[model samples]
Target: MALQHFAGRHDGNRPLVAADTVDDLLPDLVALRRDLHAHPELAFEEKRTAGIVAAALRLLGLEVHEGLAGTGVVGTLRHGDSARTVGLRADMDALPIAEQSRLGHASRYAGVHHGCGHDGHTAMLLGAARQLARTRRFDGTVHFIFQPAEEGRGGARVMVEQGLFERFPCDAVYALHNWPDLPLGHAQTRPGAIMAAADRFDIVLRGHGGHAAQPHRTPDVLLAASQLVVQLNTIVSRRIDPGESAVLSVTRVAGGSSHNVLPAEATLTGTVRSFDAGAQDLIEAALRDAAAGVALAHGVEADVTYHRYYPATVNSEAEAQLALEAAAAAGLQASVAPRPAFTSEDFAFLLRERPGAYLWLGQGGERALHHPCYDFNDDALPHGVRWFCAVAERALPMDASSPTARR
Candidate 1:
């Protein structure tokens, strides 16, 4: 059916896409989503998934560009004569997690799973691409970005470094993730800091090794590591401002091999998350200082290595408003997110390069994200597709003189 048939309808002040259009595409999209879920890939190893995405976009006759950032794909659709453009993105990588669900479509890969709903995200964006390509209801251009390695490998960063915006040149970009916490059909976002920055730290304490029962023979590296964990935990509570939010967790500790032997070295590894740059800087510095102090007191040398992975995901004011408007136009309940999530997103890289917003589409389920049993809620697919299509059409509307009326 032509999307123009229901383009005249409006719910309050927001223009609505016809429900039948998305409904017609839902079954095929669901099947595609499940297929992706069963055959999950990780990080840059998304060859199979990328091929599927490219073929689908080609089937729609989009200008497809592949081999970007190793396994990324960009599908360009242009209509009318306007120069305005918008980007809609979806991540295509899965996690190194084993599937625990007994569902028929559970991951066939033993050690990889779509525990984070990227499969759903990809399917939704593909659905939007198909719908938009079919209707050509908007002016200017829409770039469908199928990114890889979002699960800690930094596909977005690589894409940017390799000239993502330089090639596509979107005036604005938008992406959405299926949020299991919020009820289905609801959406939320904020003007800034939708997700926290992720940083990882590894520390090793070196000293003398000796028998466990020996006195004054060893520097007690394990004991120093334990103390260091306590000190690191206090960095957020005491060093960072109480008004701000930050998390410093010591997730791993390793040292001695034998029960009666004191190891010469102990290692500590963990992650830090924060929204503010000031907080991130202060925490890193304070952590280094605390590690040094502990090591000196224990008569050991401290070695520290820290890596900043992903920056905090911040949404632009105008684009954020556009996302909420698009959500409402899609007939979904929308609101400003009460607080930013502590989890980090690589989409932050894209937002840093362009004006855009990252949105959370609620998909209530029994399990939270990253859980072994977690699966993308197929019921939420139509909501995501509608929002994506609405955002594109709203961002690049056709002028009255154009053959197609504004949807």
Candidate 2:
């Protein structure tokens, strides 16, 4: 569409490319996003959402497979029913946040919305499938993965645990997330660790309680907790390697009732981010040690717990290049730059199993995913669809590349 929206709202969209055969289907993809946005579904509770996905792929003439990680849907497109294949993935879950955009397309279902733009992502891949199936442009196979529970539920890990790749299998796979900071229609990618291993920690500070004025007698857990929170900032700043990337932010602290009485216990909750498993271990050890040391130094008992969440997403160089080439062919200004993103993606589990790169698609000026006021930009559908199809056609070329050429 020449990304007419990129220029301004007043300017009309200029048709880009020959519509890729799927261009005509772009309207359907746009409509699909809006409908999903208005009627949002929660993680792992995407029964109706998943059905629509299955129906769309089926309509595209793809061999559909169901039942993975509860509601995960896989659609395989076989140009000649050959063995060679590559995969494209889209998450189907929405956040628990309420629709704050309050736009006309605001989520009709309260307490649930496609806050992360999965609606746009899912429909874009479907658009690509329609184009590929209609044109039968590629000689190899393409697998479309629609996953559930991407919002802190580990649905991707659950799907992997349930043998998603073992059962379906692919040489390489790819996925994308919408970014609010970048300009709309712009695509960027690179090699190495793009996202981090996200884990959460909860600490309970316990101590004797007494009158707030009795400073000499009470252990004052609230006072100890306050100090502990400040010290956590040092774990990533001082304990971890200077060269490695990591983050430890204390997001919530809860305890106490009245203003005068000292609370018996205080709770400290936060998240940790690291690029590698070794970094993850070091951070955990440092947290425990620091928490205990600070609490003991303050004459208070400390109860600390750590929960490892999603693993960091590491992109293989060869596969990343393949994605870039496909993106360029898709008619977008494509480039590779290591993205600095700390947000965790459950799809890291998918990349762990196969050669894959999880990409970030810019949503332009949208309020950003997870924002109560945010909305997934429907205009992004065309670029997303083209990127997925390009990845498929290039990676699984009809005329197979030489042994060295095929990574």
Ten residues in sequence with the least summed lDDT for candidate 1? 1-10
Taken over the whole model, the C-alpha lDDT of each candidate is 0.90, 0.80
- Residues 286-404 of candidate 1: C-alpha lDDT, one tens digit per residue: 99999999999999999999999999999999899889999998999999999999999999999999999999999998899999999999999999999999899888988745432
Report the poorest 10 consecutive residues by lDDT, candidate 2. Answer: 5-14
- The residue pairs in collision within model 2 are 100-372, 101-373
Model 1 misses residue 402 by how many Å? 14
Give Cα distance to truth, residue 261, candidate 1, Å.
1.3
Clash totals for all models, in order? Answer: 0, 2
The TM-score obtained by model 2 is 0.91
User: Model 1 off-target regions past 4 Å?
Assistant: 1-20, 400-407
Best by lDDT: 1
